[model samples]
Target: MTATGDADLSVVAAALGDRGRARMVLAVTDGRALPASTLAGEAGVSAATASAHLRRLVDAGVLRAEQHGRFRYFRLAGPEVADLVEALGRVSPPQPVRSLKEGTRAHALRLARACYDHVAGRLGVALTDALLDAGHLVGGDGADSGRRDGDRLPGLDVVDYSLSADGRTVLTGLDVAVPDAAPVRCCVDWTEQRHHVAGPLGRALLTTMTDRGWVRPARRSRALTVTDEGRTALVDALGLVWPPPHGPDRVPGERTALSRA
Candidate 1:
């Protein structure tokens, strides 16, 4: 690589070097373009500080900026950027569990919330397992049929999933419209410590769900909430049973209603 290439890498490194900036990147990676103010809160930084960092990330090609009316929204440039974030998360040291409240929240997030831009938590973990069990994904662990025993839950391993022939058929059967691309990538959640669907295929699935009003964003937050119709759709299409009489060992933040738009 030449000096220019080195400089480019340096820019990305610098932009990601800060915890605040990295959080900002993760916040918008899920395909939601957010304004600087929203990103600042997610990054836990001052508006001016976040804006400066965002500018640097955009210049480095780690993120893209779009101007809409009076607000400017930023997002990861592409799926590749999301991949890099996931890769880093795998090696990143775990932050100490602070308080019972914080721990509970973390558990909840892991059980059923969004990881940056993708589904995570228990839901994410279960979905990943369900895919494998259904012969939609392949090539992980020592399992011959690529099926793991029990509910491995999420965060057990940084799962790598490739779409199987049956996966395509199943996705279509579920009414998930995918692009021309073949297999999709998965990202390990930092909080849940489990793998969630990511990459192009993950993005496609999210898009389909959002388009169909199955899922929606929570107000002023990065988390996603499932809707009544979404619940029905999951059972009908993906065979996902929810609202178990008993919840998981840990539940995160307060439950918010699902929204569309």
Candidate 2:
């Protein structure tokens, strides 16, 4: 890399190096546009301190600020920023859980959370697994054998996953309207170290779930909750196992039979 490129990379890294700034970044990783006050609370910093951190992040191109009526809101620059955050999480050691609340939040995030515009965490991985098992998607096993035209997303080396014809029909039945000719891509989940559906089709699935009241975002966090109705609907439609296959008090790979159509 050129010296200029190295300098640019270091600038962004420095912006995210502070604990308070990093907390603010993670708080908005779900693509929510939050104001300085909200971010101050999330970062556990005073309003003035948070403002300074936010300004630095914006100047570093790590975040973008927008005017919403009377206040300015901040969000990650784009999907690329989200990818960087997940990549960092992949290599960073886990933080110690110091309190009951912190432990709960950590557990919840690891179980089910949004990775930017799509689902992630263990639940996300399991959802992808169910889709693959049901023949709704192909190539999620990290193999490139099924590569076809338009399988790869530009600027991202996302695996060659694609939605199958049956997958289209299944999504339609579930009222999920994927964008026309949307490419399917796999996002490497930081927590699970497994791939989950991403790209345009992945966003559509998360949107449909939220719209149908199947999943709801927790306040101030990316963690998602699957409602009782969602549990039933997901199981009946996609055969996704509830409570995730692995987590606190759960066994790994202990999944029941899928109710395939």
Candidate 3:
């Protein structure tokens, strides 16, 4: 809902009320357009049923469909829709896993997947923690904005964070262009139940990683696998030592440091 009471929110909520529709929304939360048949498979619905659902979503302004050659692909209408899906994930119960393939995909998503334009999952949360631990971000523990957030859970602690001067230097050194204005927003992670960097700094970090070939988008999915170079560079950037003297278990010797996140 907006600042003032408005019925427009109802339109969005109703569009999201259906389980199949919600599945389709999550399927494209990675910001990729998928053919209707693929969305039908993702949502486990018949083709005719999926078509009806897609039409409703498009009409509701939550999704957009484009025709390319003989195939019609659909994607979330905008980043705002992606944000709404992520927010819903924060509140909704985890969907049941019914097969080995689904289980593997779910696990991968929980490890290091993109949350719209920014990083998320275990990787996102850990990076946020490292930034705070390294003094590169300022005012965590509900102090960054100097104003309390109004819509979070009743007793949940809200930690807000901002980029520090040193953070600017670090990002510059990585060849990422930081926005002039501070865009500090905390996004709650569904699996971790913790906050990850989600504003401008988050966007720059993702872009820099992708541009430098430190990470690459997984085919047909939102999972991002860190390249060999990323494993070392990420550790250096975040000052993360596997199994730090006062920390948790060591990350696997494998290149997947997402467990550290």
Best by TM-score: 2
Give the per-residue lDDT digits (tens) of candidate 3, residues 50-118.
999999999999999999999999988988787778777867888899999889988888878888788
Which prediction has more favorable TM-score, 1 or 3? 3
Tens-digit lDDT track of model 2 for 164-198: 88999989988898667746778667777666777
Worst 10 residues of 3 by lDDT: 243-252
Better of 2 and 3 by TM-score: 2
Writing each residue's lDDT as its tens digit, candidate 1 over 1-261 gives 645433356768888998888878867755678899989988888889988989889988988999999899897798678667766765788556889965765555445655545675556645555565556767552111225547663332435557888788888776677656665666555544445576556656666777788778765545667788877776556645354211232222222232222
Clashes of each: 8, 0, 0
Quality of model 1 by C-alpha lDDT = 0.64
Lowest summed lDDT across 10 adjacent residues in model 1 is found at: 244-253
TM of each candidate vs. truth: 0.68, 0.87, 0.81
After superposing candidate 2, which stretches have Cα over 4 Å from the reference?
1-7, 142-158, 247-261
